[model samples]
Target: MKRGIMLLVVATILWGGNYICGRYLAPALPSNLLNTVRWAISSLLLFGLLSMNHKRLPLFSQWKKFALLGFVGIFAFSTLTYLGLRSISAAQAGMISAGIPIAILLFTPLILKERVKAKAWTGAFLSIIGVVILIRGEHAANGHSSIVGEIEIVLSCIAWGIYTVLGKRFGKTMDPLTMTAGAAVYGTLFSALSCIGTVRLNMIHMTPLAWLSVLYVSTFASVGAYLAWNTGVKIVGAGRAAPYINLLPVWTVIFGILLLRETVSILSVGGGAVTILGAVLASL
Candidate 1:
């Protein structure tokens, strides 16, 4: 259990670093093209690993599930996030992320047909209120802040929640690795098709540093972090493993300060704390 907790802590930090990478890349690179490269590289690497192991993916009959998973988990989440990160501070982004469990809880009843208790509902309410506070705080302090960016981040949260709830249903028949690969394959295709125009017209003459950022996000954030998370979940069980993701906002704050030189407002910090507390409550 200790080892599992350690693994999950590492996973959450790596996952939180995703925003850092997106923050670095969003200004210089086209979001769709970067999204394409990350998903494509991750999908290819996973497929290659599957090939080496002589493991086959699901048949074509499962295309619907994979497609939906790919759209929500990869295309929508990454695209909307990068678009928002272009405007919002990484600290603010972390605050938004802290509310994801609440977003998941809000959708669970409709998607899973499972009702949560009143405590969870209250937790979700607090999380939404926390989000509002965070947004208002950031908007007042940051000149570049926009309601548009905050809205996009919240939508990204909703997309991820949809993917999570749907994964519970569509992922029952497959192992974690297999399910991820399945979603990744369709995600790669979707990103490729969506970014084709951007790739052809605007994807030229990027600096080596930008390329490095793309590679880092593709391999470390997408592939390594996901594998670590799945392994942690296997060791600890998904229930015990999940709350570790709340660590993301904390790690994001740290990295945002050191790596990105972002300053966190007092209200942002308070809202983030409230948001994390709400998520923990809802998840319980």
Candidate 2:
């Protein structure tokens, strides 16, 4: 259980770092193209691993579930996230994304018919309040912050919540490796289609550093972190596993201060602390 918790922390930091990578790499590689290449690499690597193990992939009966997972988990989540980053800072995106646990908690009773305790309700409410403060900070920091961008972030969180709920339904029946492989394959295709009009093949003129960012994100952040997260959640149970993701906002704040030299206001720290505390409580 401790190992799973540690792995979850590692996954959250890596995944949060992807936001920094996306912010830096997005201008060089368009959002759709970045997403396309990330998923393409994931698909290739996972497929190669499957071949090496002589494991037969998912059958036709499971294709539909994989397709839904790909659409919601990868396509919708990645596309909207990249688009949101175009307008928001990586730190702000991470902080706002702290709302995902709240989304999952709210969706629990409605979608999963799970019982929620009074303490959990209080935690969810506090988390929502923290999110609102973070959103206000975004506006105060950037005069041009748009409501549309905030909505996109919220929708992306919702997409993930839907994926989590759906995963509970299908994940028991499907192998995690096969499910991830299938999602990557379908997501790569969907991303490729989405990029046709937005990014050109000839537009890949990124610097070596940018290329490094892309490679790091594609390999470790997208593939390795995801596999670790799934395994960790299984070992520790979802409720215990979910709160570790709140670490991403904290990591993002650290990255922003060290890498971008951005100011970390008391509001940011206090809000993040309250938000993470609320998330931990809500997940109980």
Candidate 3:
């Protein structure tokens, strides 16, 4: 249990770094190209790990399901996040991403054909209120905040919610590693297809810092964090592990201030707190 808790903490921390990395890379790299590179590397590593473990690759057998998961989770979610980060502060993006759990809860009914409880509805309401407060506070405090960026982030959250629902529907028989590997493979393909006309090899330029950021996102955030999270969930069970997701935004906020030198207002903090609370409530 203790080991699981530690792993979960590590997962959230790595994922938090993803927001910072995305923010730093947004101006330097095109979103589709970054998404392609990120997932392509991740897919190779994941598949190699699966091969080392002597697991059968599911891509051929479950191509359709993986295609959908890859499109929504990897391509849409990641591309939108990178595009959104181009305009929004990492701190603001972190706060907005706190609504992901609420988005999942709301999506459950529609995607999973499950009925939501009143508490979930209340939690969704609180999440919406918190998002509104966060947006208002961010707009007031930072001139960089963009409504379009915020919308993109919200859409990314929705895409992730749908991905989670669909993953659950399709992945009951598969292990976490296989499921992740399959999705990554198809996601990389989709991202690469999206980059065909727009992305050119000569146009891509990166400093050492940018390369390091890409490595961080592709390895640490994408593969390492996911493996840790899946192992943690297996050990601690999903319900116990769910709360740790709220820590993602908290870690992102810390990294933003320390690494990115981003500022946060009192209202933003308050709003983040409310958003996290709603996630907690919704998970229950």
Candidate 4:
């Protein structure tokens, strides 16, 4: 249990760092190309780990399923995140992402035929209110937020929610590592294809810091965090593991201040707190 808790904490921290990395790379790299490189590297590493663990590769017959997962979870979510980060601060991005659980809850009733409780509904309401507060706070603090960026981030969250629902529907028999590895392979393919006409050779000429950010996102944020999260979920069950996600924005805020030297507004903090509370309530 303790080990699981530690792993979850580590996963959240790494994911928080991902927002920082994404923001750092957004200006230097094309979002689509960067996502392609990130997932391509991640897929190779995950494939190597899958082989080392003696896990079966995804079957040819399962291409459609994995492709769907890859498209939504990896391709859409990641690409949109990078595009959004180009305009929004990492702290704002993280706070917006904190509403993903609410998005998932909204999807569950339609996808899984699960009953939505009143508490969850209330939580969703609070999440919306929190987002409004966050947006207003950003505006009040000198128009720091972009409407397009916020829309992209929200869409990314929705895509992720759908991916989670679909994963639950299709991946009941597969282990987490197998599922992640399979999805990543197809996701990398999609990301690479998206970059075909636009990818430039000069784009590969990254500075040391950009290269480091790429390495961190591809390795620790993508593969390592996924492994830790899946293992932690297995040990502690999804319900218990879910709440640890609330720590994501908190960590992102911390990392943004320390690493990115980004300023966070007080109202943004309040909004994040409200969002976290709503997510907690929804999960219960």
RMSD of each: 2.1, 2.0, 1.9, 1.8
Per-residue error (Å), model 3, residue 173: 0.3
- Candidate 3 is scored at a TM of 0.93
For model 3, the stretches where C-alpha displacement exceeds 4 angstroms are: 1-5, 200-203, 233-241
Which wins on TM-score, candidate 1 or candidate 4? 4
Q: What is the lDDT of residue 126 in candidate 3?
A: 90
- Say which prediction, candidate 2 or candidate 4, comes out ahead on lDDT: 4
Tens-place lDDT per residue, model 3, 67-174, is 888899899999999999999988888888888888778777777688778887788789888988999898888866799999999899888777766666664677
Q: Provide the lowest-lDDT 10-residue window in model 2.
A: 261-270
TM-score of each: 0.92, 0.92, 0.93, 0.93
lDDT tens digits by residue: candidate 1, 1-284: 88878877887788788899888887677777788878889998888878887889873778888889888988888889888898888778878988778766777788768868989888888888888888877877786788898899889988877776676655456665776788787887887788755556544446777788788888888777766765666667544554677898899889899999999888878888888888888778
TM-score of 4: 0.93
Give the residue spans of candidate 1 off by over 4 A.
Answer: 1-7, 196-205, 231-241
Using TM-score as the yardstick, the better of models 1 and 3 is 3
Go through the candidates in order and give each one's C-alpha lDDT. 0.79, 0.78, 0.85, 0.84
Specify the highest-lDDT model's number. 3
Per model, state how many residue pairs clash: 0, 0, 0, 0
Stretch of 10 with least lDDT, candidate 4: 233-242
Any runs in candidate 4 off by more than 4 Å, and if so which? 1-3, 201-205, 234-239
